[model samples]
Target chain A: MNLSRTARALLWAALAGGLGVVYVPLLIVLLNSVNADRTFGWPPPGFTMRWWAAAWESGGVRDALVTSLQAAVGATAIALLLGTMAAFAVQRYSFFGRESVSLLIVLPIALPGIVTGIALNNAFRTVLEPFGVSLGLFTVIVGHATFCVVTVFNNVLARLRRLGASIEEASADLGADTFTTFRLVTFPMMRSALLAGGLLAFALSFDEIIVTTFTAGAGVRTLPIWIFENLFRPNQAPVVNVVAAALIILSVVPIYVAQRISGVEATTH
Target chain B: MFWFMPDQEAAVRLIGLRKSFGPVEAVSGIDLEIADGEFFAMLGPSGSGKTTVLRMIAGFESPTAGMVELGGVDVTRLAPFERDVNTVFQDYALFPHMSVLDNVEYGLRVKKVPRSERRERALAALGSVRLDGFERRRPSQLSGGQRQRVALARALVNRPRVLLLDEPLGALDLKLREEMQVELKSIQREVGITFLFVTHDQEEALTMSDRVAVFDQGRIEQVGTPAEVYERPATPFVASFVGTSNLISGDAAHAVLGKGGTYSVRPEKLRLSDLDAAVGADEHSATGTVAEVVYAGPATRFVVDLDVGGRLVALQQNLQVSSMEVTELRGSRVRLVWNRRHEFAIAS
Candidate 1:
């Protein structure tokens, strides 16, 4: 019993220690955002809402925030539509290059984001230059969506595999068309997974600095770029910290919602 | 709606149907015709091509050769949804996201039936399956039995001419399966619709089927009424598969072999009344000690070890008082015998 107790204690301590390493920095950033003193200080000398107000009032932040929201939401929607349809096609039927198609969908996310960003940047410069389209919201959305498709595809394909080919067949047997079966049976079963993947895509697109930096062009700036550009201004550090704190809080909502809807803590079927 | 109903001759019929997955023939050339109100059963062990036949008929799978016709109209190339059919799957296939009512109403919605009429129809269908109060409950929340009923209700709501059941009661426990068997039989009777039921369990096939087609190796071994199939199996495979029998092997005189090469007798058919030389004195007489006796409530199953052959199983109807020799204990010597009329002779 003593040995078991010691083992349990050790397990809990190890888990807490690992999580502490990841969360402590975030907690510090949040604390520093509210600190009355602009300079970094332990125990946060005093709490103040001055930086938060400054962040909200900042000229570039408001525009960047709006741009970032649009880009991320747009990327997530496109990813869910194209990715889910591709997943269904590749998973359900026996077609040529099925493995290649699956591998390609996952490859964008599997490779480093820097590689994806550079490739998209080059594509926009060479491929779309003749079309006279500049790398802006559309370019950044394309880059983020390239990687986000994997998440949506993975979520949907896993569900499709579990559901098997029965319900659709049952629907079809009852005189429902392919579209009807998808609308009635397949979509309902896949709602939670698709929502979770969409949230993941949005979260990825919202804070994507490496890819956004390469694709956003000279005139356009997302919130992350705005934060980076203003981080060095001695007067703006507190505002940047405040913005970071708010972004962190805003971003965690989807993750929490995904966890609630999926109940993913339980063992997967 | 009543005026729109098709005539009785519009039953499902498969003509020379054949299906192959790559190089493997899951279901080879086969033909079947189910009358509009017939409760036809396709009985086979796993991989005997029974479910494949039903799938082909339902349009989930297409026939590589031949045609599937409903109401005598060829639907061989049609998609599953276009076919006017429904299936109760082995796993129930209830939509986990939808409530019982939604599941039943889905077909109606697809058909563009008015919303009010759809609800009434769905409620009536659920009521038939004894799940009227379970409209709001999702399939995940329902018990196994209730989920099966929901699946049944969902299929029945479509008012399909041929209801294809692919081992629908396979997931239920033995008692529930038996109860569902009776329920399914009564439902078939009440609905008076053609049912193309598929199952491997002989008892299930016998209990619910007006006619059962015993399939083996992708071929129909026998097609007959349950009584006919049980009393007179067409082949050695059917004889052994349809019911339990103690096979007694011996070289009989041409007079006896005229019955068949291998002689088999059902346990209940074993006669213990007299030790006649003509019956037991034959070269095939089996004398042995009783090995085990199992009390099965209404019947006692005795394992009598044959000295001349292997262990012979014999069953006696259990009665309150001793009518005759019911059973003997282990190591007790006994001679088990059966008459020629009771013996089922097989070709091989």
Candidate 2:
């Protein structure tokens, strides 16, 4: 159990090295947002807020931000409802092919993003094309929701496993019927888990690109797609960096809140 | 619901109740009645179907056959919520997310009781369990014993006709369990509600119950008062299960007591005397060699190998003998004597 001083020092060094490697690119993106250099020259770059101003004023950026927010929120809402139901069904009841159903739910996140995107694109084209519907923001939300379900499912499933059926049984024994027990006891216990799961599902949908690329029509542009397309354009790359910086800042709030909520849950018991 | 009337009508009744899970029959045919306001204990070992019976009473399990009647009402098809009963589960099963007051008030909330009245009644229930100051604490914030009291308060706040307790004190330590047993009995007396307690501990059942039913292998072996069941057990299983009994049967029964078939003699009833001690007219005597001595705190037990071809356990109170003298009696030859009237016939 006792680690040598040299070994402890080496472990600390490795952890710091890992964190530095992960954050260095993010730091560069933040720095490049303010760089005055036209081509993002590394050393001689002066500081300016012109790109931030440009990003704030651009109609395309505003529209894409709205679209991404709508898709992420819609996907997260659907994921929370479906994932919690699926978790409860699989956890509380036993039936044929239950294991297969669990595996199928996790398949979207397990498979390569390109494969899931292509499959969803093909299925959507066949199913919705027959109804005279073209791919739009709705298709993007659907695509994001497919992978997002797994995050919510895993979070809620873990919570359900920790919260056993005994309390619910006790509630019933105390003369509260099924719906009453759920409202008074079950929902309150699971509120934190649901919030954590929904936040994770929202974050997953927000950063997704491959599935969005395949499912979105010409009229729809999510923030990730907008960033990708602007990354190669000569005049708009710094503005793209500004948008990425803003997205990074926006995504941290939910992730941090999820971590805190789950942390509180772990300590409460 | 007059407190002292002790309603003689059956508070709970089971008529030919049976339950089976696929192939395993957990509870076979059972017919029983629990009088109103009586503290009835179902005593059995693990897998003895005692808990299954309690669950059936609580409406957690519907009988595969027969019916359950509560106060002349057939509740065989009712859900747990529909039944006018509450269960103190083995683990207490308090809502971890709610405060102790909230848990106690849950039943009232379900009935749409007004919030202020719910709070006052819940506080009163908590006071009955001697947990008044713990209203704001969550279940997770309390110890095992506190949680148990909270569960008791929660069940009592509903004022159900019957309270089914599934080994409510099983989780506490020995000292705490004994204290809670006394407290539970007093609480039951104060509440005057029918208490159907289920436990595997024989001493707990005997100490707390007005009537005890001994269960074995999905059937009731015997049902009687604590003393009646212990003294005059209807079956050999009951005689051995309720407490330690020296069972002498076959030729040994004939040789020792001039009886054939089978009989049970309580260990405490057997007396050890000098090797050549003369037996009185009303007493039966058997010469035996001491095989082992077990020193319990309040008494000393001697396992004697009888000359009549059976091993018998005789318990002597430690009040008269010092520990050294009891130890010296180990492996000594002795005569075991007991009055003939003390022996009871046990069905094999």
Listed for every candidate in order, the interface RMSD values in angstroms are: 2.3, 0.9
For model 1, residues B1-348, the per-residue Cα lDDT tens digits are: 775655755598778888898998888778877788999999988999999999888887777898899988888988888887889998888777677898899888889999999999999999998997889987777889999999998999989878889998999999999899999989989998888899999999898898999998778888899988887777778877888756655633233334336666778876433334355443344557778877776887778766555566888777662424454455677666665566665666
- Checking candidate 2 for backbone clashes, the offending pairs are none
- The best candidate by TM-score is 2
Model 1 lDDT at residue B290: 77
Chain B only, TM-score of each candidate = 0.87, 0.97
- Residues A1-269, model 1: lDDT tens digits: 45688899999999999999999989988999899998867777898998888888877889899989988998998999998999899888889999999999998887887887788889899999789998899898888898888889998898888889888887887778888887888887788889988988888888889999888888888989999999899988888888888889878888788777668512332
Q: Highest DockQ, which number? A: 2
lDDT of 2 by residue, A31-95 (tens): 88898996889873599999999999999999999999999999999999999999999999999
Candidate 2 TM-score to native: 0.93
